[model samples]
Structure formats: C-alpha cells, structure tokens
Target: MNEVKLIDMLSYLEPELLEDDYIEKDMNKLKNLISKISESSSLITFNKGLRSIIKIITFIIASLLVLVGIIVIIIKKKKPKITKKAFNFVTN
Candidate 1:
C-alpha cells in the first residue's frame, strides 16, 4: 500500500517546494516562544549558537507555510467526493 500525506500532493503543485520540506502551521507562535526562551536563558545564547540557527530555520519554514497555504486557498478548496457512485465503488 502506498500512502501519501496531503502536504505531499500539495508539494507537486509547487515547483519550488519539495516533498521533503515540511512547513508547519502555528510555527510563528512557536518561533516567538523559542526566542523568548533563548532570551530568558543566560546559559544559552542564541546570538551565536545552535538556537539561533534553529530560530532562523523555523522562521523560514513558517513563512513558507503561510505563503503556500494562502496561495493554495485562493486557488481552490479541496474536499472529498461524497456522491453515491463514490460510496458504491468503495463498498465493492
């Protein structure tokens, strides 16, 4: 059996967005939280550490997700088939 995620199908529509690249929603909030944590932690300096790198990566991903979602939504809305023929074929 071959299973593909919704994101996988959407990636095909975008030439720049690869299937391997996952951009999550609500990531902006999470990025802000990470920044706050980094700032509050004296032991961890995000300015010149791995945390900074992670923050930047997250910000990029979040931006991408938002952009893709908006573009796709404006294009069209996706929904499952609900006709009797569709159900009959599934039961067969």
Candidate 2:
C-alpha cells in the first residue's frame, strides 16, 4: 500500500493559491502607480529636450549679435580715415 503525505496533497490543491480581495486591490493600485510614473517620466524627457533646444537657439542669437557689434566697430573706425583723407584733399 502507498501512503501520501498531507503536505504533498495540500500543495496540489488549486483553491489554496486563490488571491484575496485585498491582494487584488493592492495589485490594481500598484499598476496605476506604475503607469503614472511612466507618463511623468516621458513628460520630463520632453521638457529636457525642449530646454536644450531653447538654449541652443539663445546661444546662436547671442553669437550673431556679437558678430554684428564687431562689424559696426570696424566700419566706424574706417569712417574717420575716409573723412581725414577728404579734408586733406580739399585743403591741398
């Protein structure tokens, strides 16, 4: 005759592994939290990308302004030289 142990028989019972209502509720809450976190992470990534683009545009505009200022100074310096040449020519 073969004899089965109680522990082995209990392990084969399907009803023993059934989840309670609280466990199901907690699982749903966890799923919702995970989804919210994923959504927020995507938003943060988009904001970071937008900030970098804005910074690049600002830097380009500042560089162009500086270049324009340098050109203006060079032109101003040349104007006096031209005026002096004209004055000397008129006096001669």
Candidate 3:
C-alpha cells in the first residue's frame, strides 16, 4: 500500500518479469524523444522572443511618427505676423 512497499515488491518481481535488453532499448528511445522535445521547445521560445521584440519596435516607430505629424500640423497652422512701418513713403 505504501510507496516503499510497492517499490520493494516491483523490484523483487522485476528481474523475473522484465528483460534487461528490452528495458535498455526503451530507455534509449525515451531519451532520444526527450532530447528532440527539448530542442523544439527552445526554438519555440526563441520565436516568441523575436515576435515580442518586433512588436515593441513597431510600437515605438508608430508613436514617433504620430508625434512628428502633430508637430508638423501645428507648425503649418501658424501664420506670420505683419507690422506697419512708423514712416511710410508717398506713392509717385
């Protein structure tokens, strides 16, 4: 019922029920599959990082463009002031 008793029972029966060659082959297969999964997970993580970087860069560029546009509009809407001269010449 307990973990230790279960393990002891399995250990006592393992040699009679299981073959060493089959166990070794299965362990090797499991190791190879685990290695492949690890490699794929790393690649997926890298891709996620690249995507976030791209999004941040895009957001920064868009904000800058919006700021520049607002500045341009403000500059274009301003009109130059005109002043009259104190002394005016008579027309010929």
Candidate 4:
C-alpha cells in the first residue's frame, strides 16, 4: 500500500462543503425564498405583520408603565398621611 498523505482530499471531522452540491441546493432554496419575498403583496403582508407585532409589544409596555406609576402614586399618598399623623402626635 502506498503511504500517500491525502492532506487536502480527506478531513476526519469536517464535511467537504465546498466540493459538494449542498451549496447549490441551499442557494436554490434561498433564491426561492427571495422570489417569494419579492412579490408586492407578500412584502406588504410581511411588513404589516411585523408592524402589528411591534405595536402590540409597545402598547403592552406602555400599559405596564402606567400601571406601575399609578401603584407608586397610591403608595406615596398613603405614606404622607402616616407621616402627618406622627407629626401631629409629636406636636401634642
């Protein structure tokens, strides 16, 4: 048997991606996806869906902030009442 070193021809762990048809297959899939995305109505629908998702998230975050602000205001108002009573007792 010839003890020839197949340095560039064989890899023990990595698959030979550059020499195979996998790239062509992947490119074809990408091309198909791009073509679908290029259609006017599909593009509009994608944009609309993305915008609605963003709007929904923004609305939820704003509602949460308002809720938290209301809770904080209620707690602060109660604290001032308790402090006022303590001061009145000290004055007497």
Top-TM-score structure, candidate number? 2
At residue 9, give the lDDT of candidate 3: 81
Question: Which residue pairs does candidate 1 place in steric collision?
Answer: none
| Residue range 14-74, candidate 4, lDDT tens digits | 7654568887999999998888778977889889999999999999999999999999999
lDDT for each candidate structure: 0.72, 0.91, 0.81, 0.86
lDDT of 3: 0.81
Q: What lDDT tens digits, residue by residue, belong to model 2 across residues 1-92?
A: 23467667767778756655788899999999999999999999999999999999999999999999999999999999999999999999
**Order of candidates by TM-score, top first?**
2, 3, 4, 1
- Which scores better on TM-score, 2 or 3? 2
Give the per-residue lDDT digits (tens) of candidate 3, residues 64-91: 9999999987766642211122223322
**In model 1, where do residues sit more than 4 Å from their true spots?**
1-48, 77-92
Decide which is better by lDDT, 3 or 4. 4
The numbered model that scores best in lDDT is 2
Ten-residue segment with the worst summed lDDT in candidate 3?
A: 79-88
After superposing candidate 4 on the true structure, give the runs of residues whose Cα lies further than 4 Å from its correct spot: 1-38, 83-92
Q: Report the error of model 3 at residue 29, Å.
A: 1.4
* Cα lDDT, model 1, residue 59: 100
The TM-score of predicted model 2 comes to: 0.62
Model 2 per-residue lDDT at 5:
79
Q: Please give the lDDT score at residue 16 for candidate 2.
A: 50
